[model samples]
Target: MDVAVAGGQTATTSHQLDPLQRGLLTVFRSLPRTAESVPGRPTPLVLDVGDVVVLVSGTDRGSPATRDAVLDLATDAGVVVLDDLPGRTPTGRVSLVLATHHTAATAAQHVAVRCRAPVLLPDGRCVTPGPLRLWVRPEPTLTLTRPDGRQDVVLHDLHLRDVADPDDEHPAVVDVFAHPSGSGLLLGMTDGGAGATVALSTGPRCVRVPAPTTATLDGVTRTIAPGTYRIDLAHPPLYRLHAESAARPETG
Candidate 1:
């Protein structure tokens, strides 16, 4: 990890510190000398997930001076700085502690100077709880090769839950884009058994087209309206032509 030290010196080094110690120092530095009173003693500091500790002379009259001293110590320690607080009870207190990467032992020393509370730091090593190897299923790739050597490929993917229930029905998905020359083509795919339909709002109301047996399908045509249109590919899917002009001329 990268270590940022005082005097603007930064270096890559491996070192460890105690988490509890860090927390203690943070608490010591942040504790206010005097605040609204509790029943008999001062209000105790509450430690949360990410807190750092620093040590200050408990008898110090001013909180600002103590905090500054703690900041200076942190700068010299070559560890990242954070906030701290005093723990409950009259005897001693714990400070909050945190680190940029992981907890370390140096924090323990800082905590020891201030409070009698035990120092705690997270283990330096990172432990991945769950499966290290991700369950990444490959996306389905579809390739269409025409007799004339023209070909196209489409990639399709669905979430595991979407296909988990074998009985649930789903609509096919189709996309059609038009060229500047008043011509367009259609590309889409559906579930293994699901069919689809196509349509255009301006020219053709509904066109019936059968879904391919595989996961992906594509078709090319030179006769489609230039205006925008919506292609529907619901169940019982079929492709139809509402207007004769919108249909592609049958080629030999």
Candidate 2:
């Protein structure tokens, strides 16, 4: 973790200041990391995971690199942000705390900050809780390998993978996610889409050529698309797609 103060200097580093002056700095200083001062020009911003990227300008229009870096780190690594930069809550990427210097110009330029959780903002004289917004986007993906092993592709993974089937005989195996509904999802192929029989804890499901085939489970017939699909599972322990032979069915 790292900490960056955006106002050139803050009470946090001042020896003459009180405990409140330190704000989150008291905790940030305890962590082992490097601190950097952001300049008011667009410089290339490079970052590592779990970095504390701070911006301190209430005006200056600081480095665009720093601004984009902070948001990118937050999106990828959930980095902590302590910004008093003079700008609207930089849209997109969650986990943000915005504060600005209380001034007539700032008041006119900035809008009311709205957050799902409580946040502290700097108001020139003191730090206080204010309305702010929190944005969270949890989109994920999973890869499924076709039987031919000709083409490889990625599919959206919207559900949890809890199903497991271990085969001691066939050590080389793979798993894929899917739903019973007809979603028209396609499993990525490496070379071909040959038909093969895949084993599932539920039972053996046949993979036919030019699939999007129909399978009846518990007397209900449903279409199974060619690509990997994310099942709308309701329970914790569910099944995954596994093969019975040395030939694995999926790659990712």
TM-score of every candidate relative to the true structure: 0.16, 0.21
The RMSD of every model to the true structure, in order and in angstroms, is 27.9, 20.6
Off-target runs (Cα >4 Å) in candidate 2 are 1-12, 16-19, 27-87, 98-117, 121-252
- List, residue by residue over 93-170, the lDDT tens digit for candidate 1: 344332221222333323332333323232212121211111111122222233243323322211110111112254
Per candidate, the number of residue pairs that clash is 35, 22
Give per-residue CA lDDT, model 2, range 128-149, as digits (tens). Answer: 2221111122112122233443
Model 1 TM-score, 2 decimals: 0.16
lDDT value, candidate 2, whole model? 0.29
- In order, what lDDT does every prediction score? 0.28, 0.29
Q: Candidate 1: which stretches are off by over 4 Å? A: 1-92, 98-104, 130-252
